[model samples]
Target chain A: MNIRPLGDRVVIKKLEAQEKTKSGIVLPTQAKEQPQMAEVVAVGPGGLVEGKEVKMEVEVGNKVIFAKYAGTEVKYDGIEYTILKQNDILAIVE
Target chain B: MNIRPLGDRVVIKKLEAQEKTKSGIVLPTQAKEQPQMAEVVAVGPGGLVEGKEVKMEVEVGNKVIFAKYAGTEVKYDGIEYTILKQNDILAIVE
Candidate 1:
């Protein structure tokens, strides 16, 4: 990707929603909601945001869990992605 | 009135929705949505919030405009109020 996010924003690729449950029951796509987990694709520089100094916490390629309905969806080169503030990310998934 | 907000949170009383439009037409209360304007009832002492330095901007009795659906609604002593971060406030009305 040739794009770089600015100031506390992060670019992420959403992980695919689970298709099967623990009991091995396959679920229809509509039955599942958008996944909360994602892989960090790009990281913005840690700096001031809205008069507040924000330090970027997550790194590129890290798996993360983010708040629901927190990011803007975008499609680039047919690949869907999300752009959200660092604050919207709740935790890094091991 | 005994509540004191912490961090950058502010306590506010929502203004009543307009009963009539400028065209001299009276509208039912149900036809109007929650008002975006509010009177500042109490202000939090701003310092550091979520690892960021925040400065208190609004004062008590200041009429301000805030983002729609931004605050938590609370009922205290039969008076309704909203508690939200100062960042949710859009502008101070004259």
Candidate 2:
């Protein structure tokens, strides 16, 4: 399913978390935390401030690091999508 | 301890979660989720685009809503702080 964000929001598809620990120990799903990495899919045109349009810095296909607990989670066609503001993005991976 | 972020990062202090549920039942800490509300304590001087300096849109003391899982967690002087990029912020409360 296609999803689009309104305003300065963006839609991200989270990367899957590692199933094994650094020590090579396997962890159960309940023991695993949400992944903090995501790929930018769709982004809003930009944010508005004082009736002026502010353009976005990040673009589609950028791999970004974000907070573990940021964004609203939604399920569409059995796929999960995150809606986050532009500022929530921590860094863009080159 | 005072903490300031470098670059386009911002420091946020998470608001305390409600101790009681809407039904007035007390929930255990394990069952409680992290609070999504925060106050912006500091912000970076905008982000660099192609080596050009950009100014920030938000300022200190802005009550902002961010993604539930964005930012890096740090502890200093027995207090917790989150370092997030300017884009991670969803909205500023007026």
Candidate 3:
């Protein structure tokens, strides 16, 4: 991974969706929603916006939760990833 | 109008959707998608997360573009607004 996102953007590896319930019942493909959790892979250096300098909050390897339907999906080497701005991240998962 | 969002959260007033299309065609109600543009009303101070302090890039009154279906909707004083984290904002419209 030799890529850096431009200004306020982030690169993330989306976590795989769960396929089973609490009772261990396998769910159908349509029964699960798109995964909203991911691992931060790379981050962009914050830049100027309206004369204010921004800073990044997340770091590489942080597990994060992001907005559903946010970010663009990018496929590299047959692995899927997402790229979005830092603002789309809701929280860092512990 | 006295709402202050907590930590990395933002308050935005959604821009109304256009009712007509190009060439003077009137779009029906069901044909319009939810608005993804907004005016920033308030911003939260970036906070400590994983030993890093995030910084806010956007200010009040900025026209911003965000992901559709990203934020939580709220109605106050008969006006609709959205509350989302900074990561949900894609760009600031100049």
Any runs in candidate 1 off by more than 4 Å, and if so which? A1-94, B18-35
Q: In angstroms, give how far residue A93 of model 3 lies from its true place.
A: 35
Error of 2 at B1 (Å): 28
Model 3 lDDT tens row, A1-94? 6444546788898776562232243324452443367889888777643234668999999978787577765444456666687889988866
Better of 2 and 3 by DockQ: 2
Instruction: List, residue by residue over B1-94, the lDDT tens digit for candidate 2.
Output: 2344545778787665552233243324453443366778767556552234556788888877676567676443445567787778877766
Better of 1 and 2 by lDDT: 1
TM-score of chain B of 1: 0.80
Best by TM-score: 3
Proportion of native contacts found in each model? 0.04, 0.02, 0.00
Q: Ranking under TM-score, best-scoring first? A: 3, 2, 1
Tens digits of per-residue lDDT for model 1, A6-94? 55778798776562233243334453343377789888675655566789989999978776567555444556666677888987866
True contacts kept of 1: 0.04
Displacement of the residue B91 alpha carbon in candidate 3, Å: 0.4
Return whichever of 1 and 3 wins on DockQ: 1
Candidate 3 residue lDDT tens string, B1-94: 7789887789999765441121122212331233255789989886753445556767998866566678799988998889997767755544
Model 2 chain B lDDT-worst window of ten: B19-28
**DockQ of all predictions against the true structure, Cα-based:** 0.03, 0.05, 0.03
Docking model 1 quality class? incorrect
